[model samples]
Target: MNAKNSIAELARWIDALPNTRRLAGHELHNYRKQFVDGWRIDLNLAENVSINLLITAQFPFVSPKIALIDRTKFLSWPHVEKDGCLCVFPPNTNVDPYRPVEVAKSLVAETEALLQCLLDGNLDDDFNREFDSYWLLSSDDLRHQFFSILPDGCDSQKVAVWSSSKFRIIGADEKSVLCWLKNRLQKDYDRTDTGFLVKLSKPLSPEEYPDCTEALLALISEDAPNFLESISDHIAKSFQPLTIILAISATNGTNYGVVELCRLLRANEKVSKCGRSNRVSVNGFRDGKAPLSVQLSQQTKYTKVVRSPLERADAEWALGGRGHDPRFAVLQKQRVAIVGLGSFGSFLTDNLIQAGLGQVAMFDGDLMRWENTGRHLLGGDTVGQNKTDALKRRFETNYPTIVSCESNPVDWQQRIETAESLDGFDLVISTTGSWKAECMLNDLHECSGKRTPIVYAWLEPFAAAGHAVAIMERSGCLQCGFTGAGQFSRRVFDWPAAPTTMVSQAGCGNEFQPYGITDSLHSIAMAVDLSVECLLGQLTASTHRVWINKDRKIDPIQRGWSVAWQTVPNFDTREEVVSEFPWSARPDCQRCS
Candidate 1:
């Protein structure tokens, strides 16, 4: 729409509204005049209410911004923001620039419905229904809060300090974060009692709350003469400091939770300073019965307690912090061992760490090399360094929640053979890509009464397929999936009997598949999925899963798919779901025979 036509149409709509007028000659949020067209809305009712509309130059194309003149007088809710702007239009409304007529009409109807809601007492119900949302979105409070987690039904006056403060904080850091941890163990409190130290944000000042005596006086949302009169009147009726806790959440910038701590300060009773060393003290003298000369003469005090709200983020909360399933919480206590530090192992390990693998023991005997950088999590700069050492530095700096990531540059066979055993681990992941190593680990697991579960994750040549086999007490062992040896080996996803699957790299001992990290990540994904299920106690049976990439572009393409590939039937090629193969015991298998 042209600038001239936009203004003329808006002017026409403004003139047609009931008790409304165009706000001529105004600034549009600091933009030039043509940027916005303002309008004033005055409703004729038993009690008159007014609204301000600031329609953009894109009006009839974009919805106009509407706000109430006095916002605090109304309740906060989903549709009505704390700033009193009404959310009239559902999100993502399509606006045709050619037609401001339709948008103007819809906005008018929304404004009428909003005013009616304000008049009919329907907002009260909406406010209650979305109380938490409104509370989080409310901006009346912004002071940081201190949180104390406690058992339910704890006493307030009891000063269960470290445990419960009757306040919720959306984020919990050490009380010493913004400051130092206070010495709450001084003679002022019992040492036997456990407590958490909370740092105050600089006490609430008397600028907004003048001459405030009791903590309960902080409840007044607006300024008033003697707002603490009710708190003072009820002072004689209480035995403890009326604890009032106000919580401010960083979410929608709202403050919620009100707890008051009020007490009759004893004369000459100096409470220990709520400061760091407990060295200084606050003098107590807020008695209403005291002479007006005494009360007025004293330094006007305001409770500096601004309640910071928390979203109840615990270990389970940490698991879902990155949009992960909360069910991953089941792995919080499980310890895992990743038997390799190469690309497939490291990539798979990262997935496990993010999935709440609380502690991990990384085992790798090789040194990170430049060639491995294309697929390894540790970069090329880490070349020549022990793979395990590189992984330690990477994880400690990047994935701290992985509690314990002890890396040993020593071989897995040595570790399993030495005094330190796998008895302490919940699950062992073998991505060493060595058939000999996988066989040894499988034998150890099957020999030791299957005391611990070990998952073997490996990828096929050309990244065409990957397999994760769970070798446990109830399932088939690794040797059960293979029979024959060398080029004649009949296994899951065998290569076609043609040009050797291995390629020599210009060296005596180096041979590798021409696959990229992106290809390996698919294999890593399959490994972690099964590992998570096993850790969460969901995988009760021994299972073999195969993932075939029908779209994988392999060089030197073979004539036909292997017999093993055609055996697996049920899967979605579009979604790339894995083909599940339940334990099929090899007739001539060495283990689990």
Candidate 2:
């Protein structure tokens, strides 16, 4: 229905209610914009409070918004935004377009219920739960200016701070914060200042929240006295702005708040230094500095402070805490080595890194060329760079949750020959699609006593099929799937004329199979799924997974399905599908048996 009709229906519905009325000209004119229109609702509360049912322009598509009119006292309530909107529904709440009146009724009901809870003080405890939301209610442009990487703990201690002209970063230690700074700034930093970290047992309510520098100190002295003592001297004597980081522990998680003491001055102090009236001098003597204990009490009453928002920038918070992805807690401890950074490997590496792996060591000898951009994750920006190096820089810059991203600009074969052992990695993935490299990786697995699982993935010509084979200890060897001549012994499909379709843009030996980027999605997914399964200990035996592009129409003159595929039921009718098969060591295989 049109918006005008919907609003008319809504107005008729609200007219049936006793306490609600359509706002008159003056009040109605204020809300008669293209984006919103609504009637005022006089909530049946003890105090004279009213709310507006704001029917948005997208009316039925988006549920009506509820806004509290008398917002002065309600500002401290949970889920109340700075502009007086009551966030009654959780994020991603769906709306039924056909039931616009019912949707509006439900939202109004939820708002009233929430307001009643506020009246009874039942939601005061929720202040801690929605601490960050309330903390960011300030209109300050510096709300998102500070970032904290401090480790999660209740014990208060000193933290490292890196200050720029507009931004500041707080970290648990010097080395970690410096590393983060280097990664972000792309430069070396040798110096850092100290900040006081104060742990609050509980977050403060809006009324208890501090507004000025003196109020912050009062809060620290009241709740975090022990921490305040440790940093009192540092704050009193600092010539530059001093930082205080609050790690308020809430039931959901820790919420960080940052306040900077921009200036220190006494009641009668002026902007002067090294003079009789200078606060820096001891007892009006220019030669001596004031005592630490007295400086805070006597001269810091009017200290100017900037309250900025604090973001948790550490890997732990980014990977596991924010998204609630439990895999990070386990996968972040495991190390995986990717032996290639081509089209297949590059995307596979990206998937693993985004999954929050702790350490990912990439090895690839090839440099990215313009031809690889269509299928490869590394794009034109890194066309001339080594694949591994370019990917390393890209991943680290993009995925901050990745604790360690190492790149080796050498072939996997050469890396294995030089390294002590491949056993150090939890798993090794080879997506180079080279049989020779796969054989060498198999040897490395054997040399490591099968300590590390290995996954080999490749796409057939035209991407008609893709396969991922996992080699586990005592289960099978890489040769189990292939004959000594590098052809699958139990191939799913056969295309004997596929070799004739190979195209070479650079040279005769540097030929690449023709396939669109979309055709290889299944291949990359298969490899990534198998790799994660192996790392998570979900796969106990060697296995092979194959993805068949059932929609692909083969050239009947030269290509056809293999005999092995024909035996499968409904093989011809099936759409794109992934089939799993057990991989066991072949009895006649010279490598394993």
Query: How many clashing residue pairs are found in candidate 2?
Result: 0
Q: Which ranges in model 1 have alpha carbons more than 4 Å from their true place?
A: 1-15, 25-27, 30-35, 42-47, 56-62, 71-84, 89-104, 119-213, 216-313, 321-326, 380-403, 418-420, 484-512, 550-560, 564-575
Q: What lDDT score belongs to each candidate, Candidate 1 first?
A: 0.57, 0.74
Off by over 4 Å in 2: 19-21, 24-35, 46-48, 139-144, 264-283, 321-323, 418-420, 500-511, 554-558, 564-575
TM-score of model number 1: 0.67
Best by lDDT: 2
- Over 67-133, each residue of candidate 2 has an lDDT whose tens digit, in order, gives 7776665546787765567789898799988777888888877887888898888998787887777
* Residue 127 displacement (Å), model 2: 1.5
